[model samples]
Target: MKRLHYFMIVFLITGISYAQELTITGMVTEDGTGTPLPYVNVTVKRTSNTTNTDFDGNYSIKVNLGDTLSFSYVGYESEEIKVKKNDSVINVTMSIAPGTLEEVVVTAYGARKAKKSLGYVVSAVSSESISMSRSERRKARRASKKSNKSLNKALSGKVAGLTISNGVGYTNSNSSVKIRGANSVSGAQQPLYIIDGIPVNKKDIAKIQHIDPTKISDVKVLKDKKATSLYGFRAIHGCIIITTHKGNYEIKNNESYEEIVENSFEKVRTSPLSTFSIDVDKASYSNVRRMINNGQQIPADAVKIEEMINYFEYDYKQPKGDHPFAIHTEYGKTPWNKETQLVKIGLKGKEIPQDEIPASNLVFLLDVSGSMDQANKLPLLKRAFKLLVNQLREKDKVSIVVYAGAAGMVLKPTSGINKNEINQALDNLDAGGSTAGGAGIELAYKIAQKNFIKNGNNRVILATDGDFNVGMSSDKDMKTLIEEKRKSGVFLTCLGFGMNNYKDSKLETLADKGNGNHAYIDTMQEAQRVLGKEFGGTLYTIAKDVKIQVEFNPAKVQAYRLIGYENRLLADEDFVDDTKDAGELGSGHTVTALYEVIPVGVRSEYINEIPDLKYTNSEINRNFGDELLTVKFRYKRPQESKSIEMIHILKTGENKVSKDFSFAASVAWFGMKIRKSKYINNDQIKDIVTLAEENRAADNQGYRAEFVRLMNSYQTL
Candidate 1:
């Protein structure tokens, strides 16, 4: 009986211990800031069970009661907690492990490797060291007003074989960093910067200066060949790998676009004149395409029919006379509506040889805000700008200005002949902080004005996701600011990147009011297309303040409507007013517009018949009875202020339209269908597809073929 009781007691104890072996979950954060510490090691004392804190610093492990749980990080003090019977969640706060070096170091692609196993020399600065340096600097500043120092200055003596030099005539904010001395005689000597697995170009180095010192987790300097062998020739000078704390900001879907109101038919006798500013911005089409390709719902406001139609290039005759652009008009039956006719108007700018083009003084205004931390934002932007850098000439000059919490210059007016210097500056850019777009614009314009090239292309190219959260962020405010800057003779070009929280309306306003163009880059192909193949067209302006006014003949037409250009519509008087701002025409660029017209005799629901006027003359002008309509264009030379006018009269006759017209019409139809226009239905999608397929003429670039595929994909969706 005694033996049986002893065995029963042992069994009861085993059951209780097994019941206590529940999973324990908790989070590990910094001692005082409550900031989570990712990749912290967690282990059950004296057991094989072990794990590491995830990206959010959360961890889970199974342990019996009375078992000890230990948490440890490279720069943080190790922590031990004894598990109790009632303890299901154990949260730990780790203090900094002062003066302690990390046993493991982050290598290529963010993989952690033991330092002792490395074959080459690698120097590292722990988070504790960086924090301590910042603290000391703050104390010095408090003691002396002249002790103002930047992070670069604070880090000057922290690592061996690293040199930090103050940029001449610039503040400490522009300090240059070099690792293990200069590696090249003529190339850039600054070490290549890597942030969270993304290689930053040198031009964006200023952005790294803006990062908060406290947010930096680690900084490693790789000095020898074996240390930087994985990074390639760009890292010949060495590499600086920095790991930062994961931001607390969450991704939110808050994309915005300007609302579009479709154009309605108007009677020729009542509203005969149709006036609007020409639009060369093709951002809307690519943005919409990105949405469709991502399988996201297409917003109605995102569809700009005119931009969609103009996205594809059309074949038009070259300008033969004194005009900078050649005008071509075509008349044909409308594909969407049999009762209405389509009038296609196209303008092709004169193409200039690259060598003959004027010297360019370009300022790159880049946004390095927290929102741009994604791969498609800053990384892709760097690659895209490199393509443009490759195309620069010896006579041209380039400057770089970046903005985050504030604006600062990363590179001065460096000649394009020094491509290495320019590319090195581009490589150092890192993304963080709030966007100060207004401040960036002001600074970019200042740089462009300071380095103004006479009779040359002086422009500021703004690349961003358009998520301006600080200082003058509203669309109206941006418009006002850009309008004031336009007087400086420095044009603006807005290149939008990324999605979700994208502010299209604000970018559009900036481009429109600043006398420039806008384009959205969704892929590297698009980047090549915009900044590569079409470099001349994307930068050089041929004409400014270009406007179009059309007068429909009452004798030949009853009513007409202009497709798209809802926000670009101008008062009839604005067409002749040179003081009013309008669209710009770039070299080698083409612009297209379409009008749907209803004849005087056709009965249509788009128009209502009115009784004959009693006092007005209802008789048609017999002298110009054969005339269909008249088109008048007003434009100013790139340097001229006064407007030059040109007129063309289209006569009423049977005309055969080219494949360009059919293709453009098809694009407009597809846009309308996507927008769910009241006049267009799903049934017409087939016709649009067929028309586009048939008119895919000489599609050397295969852009038309891509469009056909897009249409077919949309049909299934």
Candidate 2:
């Protein structure tokens, strides 16, 4: 007891001494522009302490007196300072240090290289203009507001073929920035944005309204095939590479927020149950379509086989009883590999007619910041809303809300019948100021609640480039706020428009968490397809919190792998947890998922064989008898808390392949080909085209024909 007391006393003294040390906090900015640089590496030289700047370019670190500190950033000279006993603040201003080999320029993934080495056509706007020193950035920020200056105006005519149009954006940021021209049919034409080695979407940029223009160290555009080939399909439309100022300290983020988990084949004996959230979102398909249409190769990571298969409607019977959706399952020989089998699970929501659908209480949350001034942004949004307004009945109500520097209600909850009033209000909205997306969401939700319709559809239709640059811009905060707002029975519909910095990932999260659907409107036709042709399907939710689980038979299957749905993959325990949220299904919406299974006698190089366990040599149960797998589904009605369950089983038999099934297989095959998947052994693009052509049924919408054209375009490339 005496020893323990002595140790405790010593520990207390040490803790107190450590606590007395000073913590230094400061903003790291470019030396000349005073623009804060994010992700700057700051480290206490000899000590292990280190930290990176946040999005705001601010950092805080704890250090003792006499501790030497080092600050460093890419493309900038390194600096070191010694901490004084009384020091509480240490602001750093780093100087530019371009790469040594030839004239250097920042490129995709924050790579700095000599321009002469690149074989592609490259253009660069350096720190001298894009991001000056701290003081210059402030002056630029103020001047931009005074003159209503934007990224588009500043960059116009600077790069030979680059075109930046006035569109929805923060007053402090650029409008829609496009390089060269549109090469993709469905993919965004804007260059992918990279800041401090992070690929940020337009919405990510929009969330921060006060970014110092000088923080943008350099902006480079890769126009030729050779320059963008490294980036895969995402760069096919052209690549706009950006490098932001950051510290050079050794920072650590072992667990990145946006990391993708690569799916691996699971051994049935070790883990037989495969569980995942049902993903009804088709954004992946549209995004990939954009890339393919642009004549760019598709990024392997972007090719979600599930979304691609689900993008097109499949012919399945509607649910007969109390359930809102029907579940269908089939097993067949794998088209890609004869040794393996393919398992498909499909769900079809009940279709509801316009007359039978509930009246809607819609809050049109329009983003009218300077970035949205482009013809494709606010103008297109106005036209899209008009199409939706035209669908509204006398019983439906609508409200107009616009957000820029602030959020405000432009039109009160007026009858949808008053189309003229809504149109007028929409026309009056002009672009300027910063983006206050959080504020706009709050006000819109408040208005939606004030005029709550107990049994009607209350929803917020947010149309923007997904750029929010004011308060509550962080993804975590935005997600929490949206999740909270969804409890008010107000669903969300995110309509992404324009390009250059488009936040496809952010919008996807908003839609998934808000119990809504997300669609990118690249043209008027897409708007018509989403808001017009699929009105009931896009707006009305038939089933919510949908989850799917499949149990593979160890006796018949060696290993299995699910294709795509990486973000939607869930733990087995989550399948039965009603409190967890999953994807939603709208009226008449169809969802499909596919799995590749290695048969018992087949040897798949993709499957890793684990050595026998040390403890239990569990025997494989063979009682199931030729059963391939048992699929179970769980879903809840839109407003329900509990969930209903359904099950289906598959067995080994002579494969019965239909035209629809073959078409789905062809689509999957095409996706794999574009992705250049290592798992696609012996599959060829010609085979995919042949299968698609042979299975192309009554091509009414010409969708299959368009796909054929896209496939043909890819073949040429």
Q: Rate the local accuracy (lDDT) of all candidates.
A: 0.83, 0.76
Cα error of candidate 2 at position 279, Å: 1.6
| Residues 621-676 of candidate 2: C-alpha lDDT, one tens digit per residue | 77887788999999988878899999988887777876778788888888877667
**Model 1 agreement with the true structure over 1-717: per-residue lDDT tens digits:** 999999999999988976677789999989889977655778887554666664456788889888888786655667899998888899999998665232222233355678777676778888777774646656644633232244565467999988887666523335668886535544458787777666665445656654555667778888787755566556778888787777231223678999998998999987899999999888888888778655578889988888888789998888988999988898898888888899988889999888989999999999988788776688778888999999999999999999998999999999998989988998899886779999999999999999998899999999999999889899999989999999999999999999876788989999999999999987666787899999998999999999999999998899999989998999999998899999999988999999999998998888887898999877767688889999999999998999999998888787888999999999999988888877652346778899999999988776787788678768766
For candidate 2, the 10 contiguous residues with the lowest summed lDDT are 248-257
Error of 2 at 594 (Å): 0.6
Task: Give candidate 2's error at residue 695 in angstroms.
Answer: 1.5
Report the number of the highest-lDDT candidate: 1
Query: How big is the positional error of residue 709 in model 1, measured in Å on the Cα after superposition?
Result: 0.9
Candidate 1 Cα misplacement greater than 4 A, ranges: 1-252, 611-619
Candidate 2 lDDT at 661 equals 80
